[model samples]
Target: MRFLYLLRRPPYSGSLAAEAIDSILVAGVFDQRVSVLFKDDGVLQLLKDQQGQLLGHRSVNKMLAALPEYEIEELFVCARSLAERALSLDQLSLPVQVLDEVGQQTLIAAQNVVMND
Candidate 1:
């Protein structure tokens, strides 16, 4: 089944981001068609220069980079969400397709859109 996982919160606040990443990994193991969408503060989860380890927290960037190896390549980031956070596409490690509103609507039209807030 095709699954779209929408991550809308920052990674540091709780385990939502971690759980999503874990889900993606497990899905990959099963050869599932999984796509991840980074929206709102979730864009921070993909920032290149994260200092989570300095705070004794595990960085999700490494997981972001490893997504492709797991065949989870349909990565996307909401353009408005990035702009709202004052972040640009250049800041993310993953090759993300910028999803504008129309694109978002189309993406969630038939597939199962799972939102993690």
Candidate 2:
């Protein structure tokens, strides 16, 4: 079945991003069709130069890049959200579809949708 995972928080804040990534991995293991939408501050998690090593933490970028290996390729990022934060697509490493307000609505109208806190 087709599924969408909506992420709405930044990674460094807490485990929300990590948990979402884990869920996506599990979904992949089960052969479920999964797509991700990084909205709000969640878009920050995809910034290309994440340096968690200095903070003694693992980087989510590595995991983010692994999505394709897990067959989760349909990645989307909220254009307004990214722009509000003054972030550009060049700052992110993942292959993400830039979605405007209209696209976001169409995305949510999919077969299944999941939101991350």
Evaluated against the true structure, the overall lDDT of model 1 is: 0.82
In order of appearance, the predictions have TM-scores of: 0.91, 0.93
Q: List the residue pairs that clash in candidate 1.
A: none
Task: Specify the poorest-scoring 10-residue window by lDDT in model 2.
Answer: 108-117
Candidate 1 residue-wise lDDT, 13-111, digit = tens: 866777778877887888778888888888899999777687667788877788999888999889999988888888887789999988988887757
- Looking at model 1, report the run of 10 residues with the lowest lDDT sum: 108-117
Each model's lDDT: 0.82, 0.86
For the record, the alpha-carbon RMSD of candidate 2 to the native fold, in angstroms, is 1.2
What would the TM-score be for candidate 2 when compared with the true structure? 0.93
Measured with C-alpha atoms, the lDDT of residue 90 in candidate 2 is 88
